[model samples]
Target: MNDQPLDNLDGDRDHATAGSGHDGEDHLRAPAPRVDGYAPLRSYAAIGDGRTVALIAEDGRIDWYPTPDLHSPPAFAAVLDEEDGGQVDLAPVDEYRMRRAYVVGTNVLVTTFVTATGTVRVTDSLNTGVAGRLPWSELGRRVEGVEGEVSMAWRVAPGTMFGERSPWVEHSPHGPVLRAGCVTVAVPTLGEMTTVAQEQDISGVFTTSPGSRHLVGLAATHDEPVHVPVPEDVDAGIDRTIANWRVWSREFHYDGPWGKAVQRSALALKLLIQSATGSVAAAATTSLPESWAGGKNWDYRYSWHRDTAHTVDALFGFGLREETHAAISWTLRTLRNPDMQVFYELDGSEPRPPRELDLPGWRGVGPVVDGNPAARQLQLGVYGDVMGVVRTYVDHGHLLDAETARTLAALADAACDAWRRPDSGMWELPELRHYTTSKLGCWQALRCAAHLAEEGHLPASPDRWAAEAERIRAWVERECWSPELQAYVMYPGSDSLDTSILLHAHSGFDRTERMSTTIDALRRELGHGPHLYRYTGMREEEGAFVACGFWGVAALAQVGRTEEARQWMDELLETANDVGIWTEMIDPGTGEFLGNLPQALSHLALIEAATALGSGLEGR
Candidate 1:
């Protein structure tokens, strides 16, 4: 993905000593100081060009970066293995402090580092091409002296993905090519001890004076047709990349409160979109544990229709019609049968079964598993989610083709027949049960389909769909509600409270009394200060689900608890990383981020909540 802030950064590669001099080529490893432990997951900022992402730590180390595509194996896996695959470092040689932010409305990350001597600003971006997505991936780092002189060192260390393949300097017509395994990177050879390759390493040390501009960049290829970008073109590519993001940002129509946060969330969600296929991934990284002393880690690189629908819905709210159409069209192509698969590869195929790893996870949490098995599970919520996008698309003055109409009709019938059966809920539980949210999803699906049918856009029997919706509603009210608990329970014949039920209020299902009571019941049962766990007894199984917390706020605002929602939102905003990126969950007590980052679902939920509270959609 050449063009989008396909963002975010980090690495851990075996060190290679730089072989001095380039008699046509040099192999070198500049000594990289070891960084032992991970900085808090909350300390990383996500930056991308739209095709790939890299997570930059607060201290100026790029801790994690998946190359070429979000679905590709990571080129930088330091965030996964600190001692083995660590980071590409660029910082002061002495004790230093730093500040970071996105450049206005764009995804270009500018981190300013201040040492005892002076300040040097690092501008990091995954450079996009001038027009469409880039033909290749490029990471552009420009260090400009903002104040007095400061000594800085920069190194290119291949991460664990390239442990057996440190960057080797080779002669190319384009100057010097750095090839490591299936990945090839081209960088400018200009610095003290320049163009040295040893143990397949390329690095340079330089000092910055006031007004001095030092640019270093990497052009990488992932088994694609390679067009090694020239150093001069690489510099121009950075300018164009920043310009492209700003140009895209102009289409955003959100003028609500938290405008910057909303835009940033939009930008992050933008990076997760698969430009070639038009699918949106759940998060940038997989296997970043969702809990400390982990047990719930799962690959989030694949696209979940449930999550993508939320993305599409939120993007539509921002007046980003292009994104909405792309996600809808791509997701529609993957629904082979009426029952929605929980997840799939960006190419609309089912993901392979998950495999376990023995490596230590972030913060010593082990059992990192990759490739999600959720693709095989029955997450009935996806029926409503997919139709929800269709609902919004029609609301925006677009007409669905006959194929989509047929799909909606089939889905309505599927929901009718399937709502009575037990299936995995949104959390993808293993055991089949009559989960309230699962039934509620089918209810919403039928209700949405019935609306389309009533409007004469679909061929479904509106009367039957309405009857089924009522039937599902009655079933949930009768079996899911717990008078003893004073709330809608997690599943039939259970008294456990579920935070997901908070969405029913927003969905206009059990609004007012039961929903408000559900909100109160869940808050008392599952709440932990500013955050809420996903279900009844998850206090220790995983971290706080940030999206559920925001969903709760939206429910509160919808129930006329505006001040309470505002108070909660104010606290949640503080949990965002320095560059305003968020993860899947949070450590409520320590405020540390838990799980994969630039989490699209969490950000989408944030937009939904803020828009609801700020625009009075909740109290409507």
Candidate 2:
């Protein structure tokens, strides 16, 4: 095996040994295990048309995508299932090294493969319409040979709905039309390519010589009265889609270290936003699992009030005022019950009950779930999440309507009543513990309410709210703090450290000394190198929560430990796949990514931590 670095294998290089090694005598042997699953995370870049998104690997494989809509069933689900699940692969047939990147300021992925014959750049994207509507949408692939000839093979397989069963397909001159109940896929092809309909998928082959260019489009839609756009129209659609994303990205105010990662996070947030209702999902895919067959998988596609509020606050920091305002409105409208629920569907519908599916989950994690039962749990922290958004908007010069003010006042009163009760904390654990963080979260709500009233933004009894906030704070100190441990425990009567307390600084419940002490204690107990887990003694169960690690970074920066904070932040960034994407968690021992990936919580924390670090450096 050649020991040369893969990055050195580029277009101008010669005699590069970049691909996985294969033996001539074992020509029928299966491929070797990739350095990473499918391909290195670094080899992939994401592209989206706001409605749907696709991840194109450096090797030109569309390994992960939710077609038709961000929340729809995936057309390429290989990111989770690898072998059994389907993927749309368009890569060189020979040993070729690949380089990939997103077009600047847009969610357009471009991957260039350099081979002994020639170099070919393949651009992949889901087409979008003028008004941000996806009309006759298709996954467009444009291949341009930059140097030498490369033989490329294309395969499109729609996996069983979340690994249920393979769909049926039919071939046509326009392309293959794949049907799976309500869903249909239309692919556009050229005359040179040969299309074959297999048992469950359609496969095609096309070879581009030097200086030749070709286009292929995969369109998916429901059973409705719609005219499928022509191949030329789809090509134009790709151009429009790129322009749309570029225009949207220009709205971002961030210009800092890790600019590309932040932009990708912002774009991902945009893609998860339900345009019609303005509700943003926590992620596009659910049940991708926190650990393989670990029973830790949970659905994240639903909108959690806490998650969306955090999203709005993060977007507000990036000068995305429109999205912030829309998200706030959606949140307020969705939680109209006065007693806010933790999660809701994109259209503000009530969340369905949590029930496990009979089918195997991603990577054989059994019993994949749809709806989240966390919605029904009593998470007192939701009041704080709501108040956080409202107060942030008010502080940022966004005027609050009378209804919003009334809601805040009512919510503050509710928090005052609920703060004394023991409930699930931010982690949504089944056991109802007297979580210090949950109590503090309620305290934050009341404190922020008092501030809003003091600032004349809301009608609230400031004195009463302040008194209640003080009581909650005192209770947390008396019951939740463990003086011997020199840190706040996960809950009263428990010595276990929790990363959730890292938010004490951001929540204004604690200053540098208290937060710093808690940080050091958590590091001692839960830190796997620089990545912090949610709690100690849960090694056999949960993976290291990705957001918790970022929370520690933010906490460190808040306490004037900027150097250590930056170091931790860089370490967290290193955990991201090649494309700078993170899952919900990481394996504490090995640092292998776990959970449904491209998690919004992890990205939201990244934005907040980066903003904190960036602001701190600017002050110096």
Candidate 3:
């Protein structure tokens, strides 16, 4: 599929609608159409089994999914390649308005399509493990008519290895078996739909009357011997999968404003977890350009030390101690090497190296790359990221073994020696700069080390750490701050403002008038009305980092600007799709989404911002 904007299509008007009530009619105007095939982003609900995840659009299309495993090749690649990309679509045959939600407290998704013919509901989920044991290994979809008879069609096209490799299918007495390298695909049907192999893909169609039901399942195998189950067994697998999600989601303790959004984010985080290794991926599918075709595409299938630590903190906040502990233990096991690379595969495999692919990128963005070169960059902040998670565990009264403490201390000592070197900051820019945020991260590490030592949680030289932290702080204040610009620069001696600096106040760097001035300066220079850019000119050069906008709201709330923070918070919330999902970036000019869709970082920032605003309201 070409990456041209969907609005450029001939029948694009079929999906147009006025924005909801937020600011005013003009504030909600849709952006201009593009010749590209990229559609206006839709709300997507994620479902997973702690191994692989599937993204089901509000319109009932499974647009993005990595099969067999989170890091495995994508089965539904339409999210990246619109036309040739594979997808599993189950929707009404007639034009239908849709409303969707998750089964309360579970990852099972329920999408209802209301058409002139009638209304039908579709439930989607991956068959999950039972009591920590792998199940029948299936992706199940159940469609039932809720009202009048509604005709529906379903299609399944499994793209091979990021759209480069195509699978071959042959029929047997049992059913169909698909082969692609080490992966295998099997489908069992409970409806009267013909399964036929079309040029490099397989598809089927089914319809139902009121009170009727249909079921379809896709199964795959890795190293183990494969088995194809009968279609009748699909119902049992669906029941067990739904039950598993329900029981697991019951562990959530969050019950605050934006509770639904929080739960969804938690589910997303859970979906990214690799059940076999307990490691969490940063995102599901990769090579979705951060800034369309501008060379900002990255692979997020690996686990980043920074992202995992933040995820642990977020999960801890929701009272998920078991999951938090599992992640921490995974970190300890995988990060045994003192010279930790930035990221690793879920099973603690080697760092993923950057490799170019033959397929086109999402929205016609070229250079569809796989793996990430950032994995090998010397980012000093990783020291802080690791230490931060350790400190959080110790502070929260979670047990940290003596060996873990000793390893942490040694890691901190390594940071002390490495902090002076130049490396890529959190943003992962290609060019290495003396990033102020990176230095601040090192400072934070030493400070956290000092705190842990003083609390008797670890054996460390507090005096040395304290002195080192102060030295870094002085260097930042003296070298990184631009008195002429009245704000801290992106790097030393550079006047460019980076949205990352907004993190200082949240990280407890400095909350005085100078910090406030810096925050306000970032708001003025980077703010695109309500949606702030990560840095100036990023929209054309790099994708607008949507997380930075939430960071702005959190920064304002942190500095006691409650009203303005709330206003911006409302604006950000309003930008979410009807079902409340956020992408990595939002187009400032058109309100169209850019970059990767359903980004985990963007949702995490939303949770933080919403929680901060909710707490402020309670305090008042």
Candidate 4:
């Protein structure tokens, strides 16, 4: 809320102050590596203010930021199109080696740059207001000199929405402002520096001496009067944001295996949870290709019922009532309509059909999609997703309203009827067939419904649900198990194996000798190194799905192979990027990131796997 109009922005903007010195040196004399002007996905770290996230590369470039909200159009998106996409660069002018990490317990990033002349530290954050989230978004960069004097250069450039709209700079009484579409941005500088205003950007250079501190603030708004933040207030907000994140992180109660990684995953999931609503975005970005040859890109900013359920379950493990309740309540309220889609918009509305945008995609992976087509598919697993979370909610000593109870009963009845039909399954494949995982999900749904009815939380007939669950069990056992392969196949008759079957271990569906044997078959067929391809033919097209590997950890623990699960967990934890962020997939051979980043499902799976190992409890 430290934003005011141009009339109030007149002041001596020199707000330099000496701050604590940073320790650590990662030295390299070479320039940052780039291929076609794009940094490697593994080279990026993230900082956010709960409303939206900004991806910052190790070299100090603010790339791939969506304004106002996570799903909104980008205000800075050099990660996608490099040339036309906007970016904010703050780094040493000369060649420097850099290393970065989240400031211990918070999302605020600290990157230390070591040059031949001296060293400097850049602390970056999307500032939060005093009360809570701010109405206007502010990107704060605090530069501190740790050693001898070093020269630094910065640029604040707003893009044309990848040629969708044009950006122009307007000179005002206070300074130069960049306007593109509905977004208006003001770059305010503090400390000893010189700045130049051009047609499209504001450029600057400054020299920092030992103990000198400087700040660069970008205050922006969409469809509203832009606020030019006071440099002093922006500096204070950065400290306040760090304290706030630390306070939130303290409430996370995990002491299991890979505790640091688990907490990082939880923080990453928090970034995807929109504070305005309780909806959880599947990932932070869209159109980051799953395949290098293009055509696999899809938007993940929407909320899927399955993901919400998983998020609720993971939050519940940490005893986080607010997030768990908000997610469940929002999902149940959004699903009041009889027909359920695969996913919904973040604001509890039905999503529009997928549309491909006109832009050179990330590294020229074309057909950058804006919405998702999977919303139209009939994924029967959503039934299990809903019922499972409701059961967990009730188990946690919470009550369901009368309307929700009735609606769930109806959904249970529908699941009974739908399990017999072939549907798109969890993967949302174009060719619908009798997917074994989808059938298992229906079986789980009926079982949970019967349990709820017995506990008096539901009004449905328990007998019918139990009978249907038994029938599903018999059908899956009879047709889905491939005797020759000694494993459960993808469908009734196909010989292909899918790693999604590992999810059944945590679903309370099967943990018998057969299920244990199936785990071995899956690892043998799909695993490469510490990762697993999603299904039979995914190795031919994409990298191994990151979440599937974590699912294996939970499956192994569930089947009583604790030693194997712990060893596997150790190896998988090492696969995360330096900042503990994970993409949708990882190339097993090259260790490169793929697909959308800071993926919620991958982090959620990590939490679940850790909980499974620590508690030694059967899947709920």
TM-score of each: 0.91, 0.89, 0.90, 0.94
Locate the minimum summed-lDDT window of 10 residues in model 2.
Answer: 1-10
Count of backbone collisions within predicted model 2: 8
lDDT of 3 by residue, 555-610 (tens): 77777776878788767766666545567787777666766555667777877776
lDDT by residue (230-291, candidate 4, tens digit) is 89888888889988888887888876656667777888899888887888999889889898
What is the alpha-carbon lDDT for the whole of candidate 1? 0.76
Q: Which stretches of candidate 4 lie over 4 Å from their true place?
A: 1-32, 617-620
Candidate No. with top lDDT: 4
Better of 3 and 4 by lDDT: 4
Q: Could you tell me the TM-score of candidate 3?
A: 0.90
TM-score of 2: 0.89
Candidate 1: TM-score?
Answer: 0.91
Global lDDT of each candidate: 0.76, 0.73, 0.72, 0.84
Q: Show the lowest summed lDDT stretch of 10 residues, model 1.
A: 11-20
The C-alpha stretches of model 3 lying farther than 4 A from their native spots are 1-39, 133-136, 194-201
Ranked candidates, highest lDDT first: 4, 1, 2, 3
lDDT of 2 by residue, 1-620 (tens): 11111122122111111222221222222222345355533334566665666766656777777766766666567766666556887888888766554555666666667777887777777777888767655788888767656888888887666656568876666545787656788777643777777867878777877667777778788665435567787767767877887777788887665565666677766767777677888876667666555677788878888888889888887888778888889988875674468888877888878877655454456557766778888998888898888888889987887887887788888888998888988989888888888998899889999999999988766999999999998888888888889999988888898888887787878865777898999988888876777887765577778888888888887788888887777777656654455677887676566776567888888777777777666665
Clashes of each: 43, 8, 10, 0
Q: Record all residue pairs in model 2 with backbone atoms less than 3 Å apart, i.e. clashing.
A: 41-578, 42-578, 43-58, 118-148, 119-148, 160-165, 289-595, 290-595
Model 4 steric clash pairs: none
At residue 427, candidate 3 shows an lDDT of: 78
